[model samples]
Target: MASGLAFPSIFLLESHLTEDELESLKRQIRSLTTDPGKTDVFLGKLSNRERAQFELRRLGVVTVEKRQSRTRASARADTDSAPNLEESPAKRRKTGARAPSPIVISGSSEDDEPVQIVPPPKETDTIKVVKLAWFTESVARGEVLPLSDYTVYEGRRLLAEPAIMPSPAHVSRAEGILKRAQADAAGSQQPQGGKPHFMQARRKKFDGMPPPRPSLTRMTTSEKERVENLPPIPEFLHTTYSCQRPTPVHGPNDKFVEALKTIRLARQLMGDKIGIRAYSTTIATIAAYPYELSTPSEVSRLPGCGPKTAELFREFQNNGGHVREADDDEADAKLSVLRLFYNIWGVAETTARSFYNRGWRDLDDVIDYGWKELTRVQQIGVKYYDELQELLTRAQVEAIADRVLEHANSIHDGFQMVIAGGYRRGKALSGDVDIIISHSDESVTHLLIRRLVLSLEKAGLVTHTLTLSTANSERGQEAVSWKGNAPNHGLDSTASGGVGFDTLDKALVVWQEPMEPADQEGDKAGETQPNTNPHRRVDIIVTPWKTVGCAVLGWSGGTTFQRDLRRYCKNERALRFDSSGARSRVDGSPVDLEGYYGNDPATDMLTAERRVFEALELEFRPPNERCTG
Candidate 1:
């Protein structure tokens, strides 16, 4: 019989887990759940307490340190608190008794000693972060183990973060900016056609009055009248999951969605993960909304759209369909510089912030100041920043896909490919191309990415190899099954192990078109010149035939669509869905929903993807219809 965990629920922090390793852990812990709110313990391959705390913080689980253990508390406080105190003379007089003096053993006066204060006791429940080995060892012994030896941290999870006290400089800067904006507003409102004296008096009047701001407050109408005036919320909107409904490429509220996206981008640059998620949820909900928002009440009617969201919508309507924060965010100098650094291929938001803190303002600054400090991939990113930022046309993307397919087929026959990412989601242009390749023969797919990338490099199509991972192939192209019976995934903290959910044999490369012969109009007419094609980012993924359906479905949708799909799978089907494949959460078995629809391997990718939707009991949404922006 399987033993229950010592903790009520466990949250697996996704730091260093391959497909198989994740399944193995889930199988061992029967109480594993995705929501961090309900989790009592966090288990991961954590190094120290700081990392454990950071993982919790990243998931929006704010926490505070609870009271120390009795042993530690006693050591920190005075050994004899009762003997350290002396009664007041006034109290002794009132009681008609002599006061006892505090004992001073070191031949010093009692008044010479400093006072020691004790803090109040904490009453919140303790949250534990234990090492992964503890659980495995416990399972091996067929019993739950004590967490003392393997515990990394013990704290109390905060319901919400405490209010932060801003620094003096921050407050001063905010005041200065507000004052400047008010001055500008006053200047713009001054009369231009009046005489000098009249204009002077009008300016004086404006200076004494506050700038006219738009009203963002909700309407004071009764609930009955409000409901009668507002449109009924759609049935699909009732569900917060985007995967349950179709989100088209473009919606009636694109303008509002774009405005919200700008704010979200600003939040990303500022390293506000929680803010980014909040804005992303708002944008996805609005993108999936079918009606054009006419009133704040209508916006409020949408699910996940509360009074605050409605106020923002009201502000947008009052300001001629523009969010004030979005405009301000674009004009902010600090954000603009951070945005520039963040656009580099190898730099994440945190790295971008680091660059800003290091006083590097632009690509030239990065090259001149931090060239030696950069990673190989970061150096390449700086070298071709502009070329990589250029968007690729549909024709260019198709041509690149064809070239990749050609190289792939030459290495092995009977391989099939699907163009995923924004292109598959019906975008006219994409920043990069994502190609998911597979074959019916599992042997043929083994370590195929390395050979394909080599061929492309030899053909002069691949300029730079950013990262190459063979995790899937190294595991023998088999779907991860949890029964405590699968082989070790054997992943480490290396680039080759692959990061995140896309744990397939893959290569991230900088691709450029091969040089074509160009006729010169000058003295050297007979000589051929190099083609001036721009470099593009490309990701080549190799999946086994059985799970190709999951791979395609995982990579084909928008970011929100993919996130919500995984959430839906976890919440509804008790399955974990990723680009690699799906696994049952209850027993860690491979959820076989792919490659069962057809005999031909060439057309199996798409049909298999549809089969995943059917098997999961979800409405089959086409790739183009998954634009959950």
Candidate 2:
């Protein structure tokens, strides 16, 4: 095989010598793909230069000369061929007439499907939109209504944030108006129920709509080709019913589930096709700009605007959707509703729809109806429901933390306790208070915990309790000695068998009980959003002192932060840390931080803090200061 010349496309040039050389050289090339057995066959025929180009291509990279090869040839062809002149083809389906809008179906209450979704661009300030005449009347057509009146989920979460797709009702209304206008353009009287004067006002609003179109006339690169190949509207895919969140919490949360589902569906319909930029970061960057540029080119001067991505933004803004295809997207519609309902606690897909159909729209109705009818725990749930809805302020979090510490101190000597959640996070607010309790004397800790809950409840601080008993040291040793022994908590072998987050206790209680319930479903399924109750969340855990570090570390985190921490701990530190314990990944050697070691919860927190700091070699900082992106 030649090492100097480039290879032609697989579909194009082939020769006996090339084929023979390909087979011979194939024996030497290594395969990286899953089909390892076939790598050499593709590599055998290529010359060294071609192989180099192929490797780069394999990495999703296109070489300059390779790109230039087609482009230069095309340029020559374009010079020879007459430039085709034509209007952009219309996207509205024209099978004698346009189609109707689609009816969206979000998932059940227990499901975590998105009800509504905003199609935020994966790139710039542009949305790929589809334009068409009003859908057929037979379809479920509805207009996007005002935010406050319509849903529990915000538009960002509840509906397909289609840049230009009108609700069925809105599209019909617009179509009716436009038909009259088009008729007026020809020679005709205005249609009945269609007031030309009123349409003019609506038309003014329509004309002021955002513009969109993307063009990559900047630098020529393979990335440009990649961008050109991608359409703005996402390709429709298979659907599945899955829970987005499974919080074993009590409350009316149906509306929230629907909303969340809608959000997911809309996303599936939109920018999922192209790109991976952070939305908050992207929005912040765009928002910082002084002037609004509807097209991507206008903002090309800004940093991070790759030529290919910029084209996409410009095009998205100009067009209501992708360059073509105006079929009513059912996926987006379904997602819109799901997103609307998922925002509420205890809300799921099925319950959200029920509430929507019954016109029991808001949180208030559910609270009034379900509070008394739900479980005692759920009844307590309704009491603090509103307070829980609000993110806790820093002061409120502190008060909760002190209350948690009070219970911890009383548990036993050498018992340790630390307040986590948003308060320890140093954030100004928190959703719920988290308390981690542990003790060095693992043998008697469970006994202390049981007593602690009873006392706290009697003191009126602990409103509800969920206990998950764990194996003592002796019990663990005995289990290991036995051929088959399992912790009754039902945690898997790979993870904790203990219930809850760990072998822990969970409780939800309001500081002040404003209203007591009779008999009601508390945290029951398919519950509606609360309207009458003020409820809040509270989580508590008790791990032994040896595992205290892991418990605290897990507790003091944002989602992504925790993810990265785990990666670092496992991959870099080769450590295993769970709510129960922190041990060596290679061998279960216990991690012991001697300083401040104790069965006392307070001392345990200090020791765990010190241990983590030492392991990471970082300066000692309170949980509040641990926030990391």
Candidate 3:
């Protein structure tokens, strides 16, 4: 009787239902022990078969009409029921049927009929569309009701299945495995005395001694040599603080580091923030390693590299410098399309995934199907996707930096600038340019980004401004003040425009150099000027003189180095560091590390930056030696 009340997997159609109404129905469905899935029964407000089919198709479900012939349907059901003999006991229990006890027949043959474990009709791929009132009326009556009157459509699924329902092939394989396990257990019974047969076999395998662990026995020639002449581990590597280490541009294990970077990129595209952080630490540690990697054990010895990291390294070595997961990630059709969308200037991982889910396979699809749904910045990004992804050579980057600096000084004289990011890290090419600008006077730096952007735009050097954050200036050029150790109390939420760390007044813009005079001198008959310079992405950050040190240090280091620097400050020094300034974590007081070099307001920006390193009790790492990417 209880088995008669079991409902097939049911899916709720979101169309034609209010949010609250949908949630209410979902709660009732959950109370009835019906979980969400690709289901044979679809409950909805729909009343017609065509409307039901349209709703399913709209949600990416395709179906076909079930055969109306009773004989054929009965034959198909019989064939399907035979396979149910392999269904797991757990699923049978879920359907309110008791699992049968295992029977061991002495002379049972392979050709014998399969033992039925439960008494219940098997479910099929035939779908039925039931009106919403059926569910509500059934819940009101406090008993499961028949669906014959409420069902509007009946069809065979073209392609869909419940996720938890194992295929017949899988069930067959599982049964075989279970038989093998039972046979092994029955044969391995203790023989009258000492130990089990398996235990005796293990003892005889290694001459009565326990076998050596796999890791210790798999050393290669280079690994053996590396062990013999082990290099002195750098003292800084022991701390796990990237700020304490010097990470050069080209490390001894750069090739391996680059390979790991591919995996990190995949993690980023998948929006796995924790995985990204973990891989970043490992990548940074490998990038800073002084010796070449010969074995997985060598990687395992590093601070952040765990056993999994070492195993991946071994796999990487075996695959001729490629990680299998990274290769698969790159080759995945969905991920490849996602990567294309992610490379667009303003599209984040979430946005890229959203675009893919919307059935937009490419940029053209996005433009065609969802152009109006995009933000202004995203539209601009799509408009210049190829141009934005083009790499900028060092010379071109320098030119852009020079132009930015010139524009900054034009808005307010005596502005000092440092070209940060990949260019400062000695990369031959950069995807974008990051320039940090500062003025000795706080008043000059306050709200300076707006004027600078206006100046650049006026000169036709700036095409679009994506973001203009003045959170630092809004807070009167102050650092984020910390609250006492109470959750959600006294924190300065307005210090930064976005979340975490950085709060400097900055402008994220698209830049294109103005046409040269020679190119501007086109035919006198009103020909348009040819702008040969390619469009480039640029970030201009403005910082007050007092906290210029923090700005330079924060903006110059690689992503991991900057992240670990802030982490080190919080954990070791009880302070918070960001592009805005430093503040004591214990209380909400600012920490002035800039004035240590000199009382002079006009001190050189590099000297101020060095003063920060000295005050933080860390060695000053040159920009080129801070490439922990």
TM-score of each: 0.66, 0.42, 0.66
Give the per-residue lDDT of model 3 (tens digit) for 93-141: 6666555444322113343333322222233367788998887777667
> lDDT at 406 for candidate 1?
88
Q: What's the residue-level lDDT of 70 in candidate 2?
A: 62
The CA lDDT of each predicted structure is 0.74, 0.42, 0.74
Flag the better candidate by lDDT, 1 or 2: 1
Tens-digit lDDT track for model 1 on 1-629?
23454545789986766568888677767778899888778898886776787788788876666656578668567555546556697756556544333322210222222222222222445788889887788877777888888889888764331122333444544564466457656775532333222111121112123434544556655634765776677788788788877789988988888888899999988977667778878888888888777777778778777777888887798899888999999999999999998888778888999999999888899999999998888898889888988999899989999999888889877888899888988889898888888888888988888889999999889988988988788777766544332222321111212226237788889998866544333346655555577888898888988888888887787777777786687669877667777778777877777644345443568887887888889899988788877
Q: Model 2: how far is 382 from its true place, Å?
A: 5.5
Q: Mark the regions of model 2 whose C-alpha exceeds 4 Å error after superposition.
A: 1-33, 36-343, 346-384, 411-416, 466-500, 503-535, 587-604, 616-622
Off by over 4 Å in 3: 1-217, 220-222, 483-502, 521-524, 530-532, 596-602
After the best TM-score superposition of candidate 3, give how far the Cα of residue 83 lies from its true spot, in angstroms.
17
Backbone collision count in every prediction?
A: 1, 126, 0
What TM-score would you give candidate 1 relative to the actual structure? 0.66
RMSD of 3: 14.0
